[model samples]
Target chain A: MSEQLTGADILIRALEHEDVEIIFGVPGGAILRAYDSLYDSSIRHVLARHEQGGGHMAAGYAHATGRVGVTFATSGPGATNLITPLADAYMDSIPVVAITGQVGSRSIGLDAFQEAHTWGISMPATKHNYLVTQVDEIASTIREAFHIASTGRPGPVLVDITKDALIGKAPWRGPGQLDLPGYKPSVKGHPRQVTSAIEMILGSQRPVLYAGGGIIRAGASEELLAFATQQNLPVVTTLMARGAIPDSNPLTLGMSGMHGTYTASTAMQRSDLLVTIGARFDDRVTGDPALFAPEAKVIHVDVDPAEIGKIRNADIPIVGDAKAVLGQLIEAGERALEGAPAPERSEWFSTIAAWQRDFPLAYDQQPDRPILQQYVIDELSKRTDADTIVIAGVGQHQMWASQFWGFEKPNTWINSGGLGTMGFAVPAAIGAQAGMPDTTVIAIDGDGCFQMTFQELITAAVEKIPVKIAVMNNANLGMVRQWQKIFYDNRYSATELSSSIPNIVMLAEALGCAGLRAESPEEVVPTIEKALAINDRPVVMEFVCDPDAMVFPMIKAGGSNDEILMGPEDL
Target chain B: MQHVISVTVENKPGVLARVSSMFARRDFNIHSLTVGPTEDPKRSRMTVVVDGPEMEQIVKQLYKLIHTLKVVEHVPGEAVEREIMLVRVNAEAQRRGEILDAATIFEAKAVDVGAQTITFEVVGEPSRLADFLEIMKTYGIVSLVKSGRIVLAKDTKSATKKQRKSA
Candidate 1:
């Protein structure tokens, strides 16, 4: 007979079997047993100040490391708080597994204390969820949660366990068999479709390679670079795919979107064929779907069939893993190119180069102007190591960081891309730092964003994670203020954060972090040097930036990308 | 035009909720839905009748669910559809013979007979059931319940995976 273990023990064992290195969560009344079991386990737990911070941290770890990130919370408000992060992960397609403790079995429908339908409440947000009614089901629930999280087009999954089941005894059977019959994700591209796509690529005069975060998730960066370089196709990476193709490459056209580069925006509008790989044409990327790429014939490739024709119709839809499909395309291209002239898209390249030269990403770093946020990002990019992972909170600073920082590698850029959640940088930096211990992790945040989740730094300080934070104190909600200045007639309704803000440096010191501030350009490098020297604890460096700077190359909401503004002068 | 989507799923708690919630979020127009155990105790079948465009998306989304095993959409003329209903109608002494005569013509049996009412159980095509219910309404309907709709391919060639094994 197999030995018996409590449901909590089974859960901890299953997580360990899945090689979970760390879990971010808070302990509460309902999850006491699970916490007790975790105390003696091999897995490490980082106690979070709030469930929401922990949820984002898990997402950050998943986004950075390409592994399933895990978090735990008690029922009711604790689980409800995770909904936002789960929704963010769903929209961005990150792999996160969230586990929550529910009330006792008998108290399920009796309005028990701290009880909420965790599974039901998180249904719309999570990729899948489990409501455990039996102690024996804990093993399979944990296994399936991890599987569902990391497979196909990855997203978050939730597992809600009852307190009674956690304390109840069940036989210690190792990993339970997964019974998911409906989840069969296609890997290889269909042969006929691949041939058709090759024909389109070979026949087209102006072809562009569009890549999204799926390349990083599939680890197809090498394949992407090889294909682009071989075919001499100009490549455009989205915000989520900054590192898929290095921006330094002569063939790369940087990003394409609302605040994307002028060269990339123009190239996408003029391309005759767009070979879209792993990217869903999000509204932000393609401002107006119908008028997005008027002359382009789309050959869309994605693992999810539903996303193939969800928005814009695809002339050739290939549903398969990005890496597998790219690998297939490379081999097919070699055979098809035999004895044929090597294709060279020189004319298209020259057009893109002229745009880049005319409108390079420029910022006024004049000594007369106040410390500019873009200048700080440029300085940080020059000083940081090649492997440094940059996490950004949503706002004007996010655009500035993406715009200024020369991101040339995959898995090095992390942000709340789809949901655009503010306050993601602080905890997410800590989580990424914890996941990649040898690499430097920095959080580039705005004043309004920093104040939202800087408290999570205490967890890093006490844990000695040594993540750095750079707060751009522009004295206002920069992004919203810019919008109000442009769209809302400068009313500035509730967008100002400068009226009565706390001293961020003092707040950082109070949280046991090395705090420094730079108000002038000369002071910037010295403060950054001082912050980088601190290895024992986290450092928070505040840069008092100009409030007038707004993100450029703008496309107004519901406007077509064909009419992209170049800069403030264009506005 | 309405479309019939037949899905086979594992018999488990919350499976129905997962399937129904998916439909609600996708905004699929569900005219009627029915679920019951299959020959195998571990599996169940659901017949959902939905309308509107995006018929391809309806099937694609259902296949995304973890518990779903198979999904088949039944075309209009290639499949047979039926509905079962139990309708109770008011029967007065003067109207008893007339109601009985109407039920006889429609091949419906009196499952229950109270002093003032008679419950008729009938199984037929949806249109046939509507025709029978039209005549019974003259005697006045007290209450009625229906088993939405169940569908099957006209020939045995269109059998499910499990059905093929049993055959």
Candidate 2:
């Protein structure tokens, strides 16, 4: 049945058909018509303090739930504000659909009020975008936008509609056909490639499974665990793939990269075969491309064909969905090893075990002294459940959380890995908490990162989202300060944050949330317990940590993984 | 090395701007670019000549664009190419006869003849047009315009036959 409807109504109907439960945005002049239509619908709207916050919130929702996140904004400033999160989603391969309201078509180039060339600005950042000038095209455009955003190698997509288009009337039919002929993505792995990969896996003496975010994105953590266990291979998860495999597993090496574990990097450097699944060999992961995994022959499996051999040459490149490829690999392995015992690798296991024991992740702590940042994270990890979602901001605190948190399942660790955007924790935590209302959500943020987007705590309090926030108050830009101390002749230039900083506890109280402070080691446990006890509103717990703490086991930029700086002794 | 790339994109507003902006952002210099409607009404063809060492990367990146339907690199021997040039030169009656003689030699057509100048149109290889323009420059050239190179791949049968003969 066809009925007369405005473009705004058509857009809302399309979103409803797609089962979009919530939208994070702030309404403005150009989008007022859509907001009016939104009021008459059943979907919940989350008002963010800033457009960037809304965009990050949408990203968090998508990252946690594996669903297409939706956000709306006005044309000029609103669209510009969305650039950071768009770039963030693009770099991290998150699926997000952003809708913006542009000035009427007639006044697009006349320098009208709040007019911007949104489609042009978003071209490089978005996977795809559309500009709708007709009312009848709204439904199909929305359908296509969702399809493109959530498909293979998902990323952000934008759709900008002119105000005249929104106000215009048309007969509302259901979402029409998506007629995009040039946008097909491959989903099944080639049989010959799968056979070759299995042969390599079975023949190697020293093999390491380098799992990446694609495993989590493909929701194939079970298959990965089965395959790794079946092959008796050691697994190293990258920063974005932290929770893809349980850290408690005997074969797991925490993270491999700039601040990765000594065992993981050494394993990568010494292994004969490095099978990479769903993870790009980023500069942070592969410190020096020529020297990284020098003895390893790579087998890369990813859904995007362009990612294969982009940085490192793949001996066996499989372009297919991670889940499908992993399934095929498992079946092929079972057939190849039929009625045969698994190869014994006691020698390889002992070597890796020695590395793990000799250079375990450790930090010094003294009783009755200033609190250590690592201690705070350790305690939080101890107190939280295995299914708790831990989100962090960028910089030193991000590294600490990634190291200290014991992730046991996928979708439990979320952070800004690719773009390294600070101020991502509070709003992202709120979004994650909203998406998974029954699960506990925690944001571990640094004092520097917290100062960037802490205003979103107001939204959390008003919306009654109970998320626990832990601020590791180091009172300085810890990472940059450490770098200056080491490489810049110990000249502390512009890294300190102790000058005229606001009191965080009072700030949180002012924002209508319960705030607690822990200055000593004794207060850490009680404060965290109290914060965890709150169920009606959000709670912020501030831990005054030592400013001199540094992330160790560091591979300096442009340095090989073999030249790892373990600590001050090495320096 | 200089490489010519042809791109097919959906016929929509601002696509040309998008393509140019991509080149500008990547800092890839475009030696010449010509865009026009193709036989398919919904799509347009663009011919771009670029000077770079990363032509493979450029082709891959261009294909990543959502609106871009197809991209192909035009090899010199496997493709037929042409360029059109229109030149208006100073011709004051006595020089008109000499200019007409040069035009005839170059297989050019006299399109317009004003009181003091004459316009001639020529179509040929880019090198030939450049040589003709050089000769016309000596006759006191007034204005000139050169359409960038346009290309079409030869039929598949002939291309394969040539490859077999080379092999």
Candidate 1 TM-score over all chains jointly = 0.94
DockQ for each numbered candidate: 0.32, 0.24
* Candidate 2 lDDT, A48-96, residue by residue in tens: 8898889988999998999998999999999989888888888888899
DockQ of model 1, rounded to 2 decimals: 0.32
Candidate number 1, chain A TM-score = 0.99
* Cα lDDT of model 1 by residue, A365-397, tens digit: 988678999989999999988788999999999
How well is each residue in B49-153 modelled by candidate 2, as lDDT tens digits?
Answer: 999886655665565566677777877778777899999999999888988998998999999999999999999888788888888988889999989988777
TM-score of each: 0.94, 0.93
lDDT of 1 by residue, B1-167 (tens): 88787888899888999999999998888999999999999999999989887577777778778788888887677678999999999998789999999999889999999999999999988888999999988888999999999987779556333211000
Best by DockQ: 1
Residue A251 CA error for candidate 1 (Å)? Answer: 1.7
Positional deviation of residue B35's Cα in model 1 after best superposition, in angstroms: 1.0
Q: What is the Å distance of residue A380 in model 1 from its true position?
A: 0.9
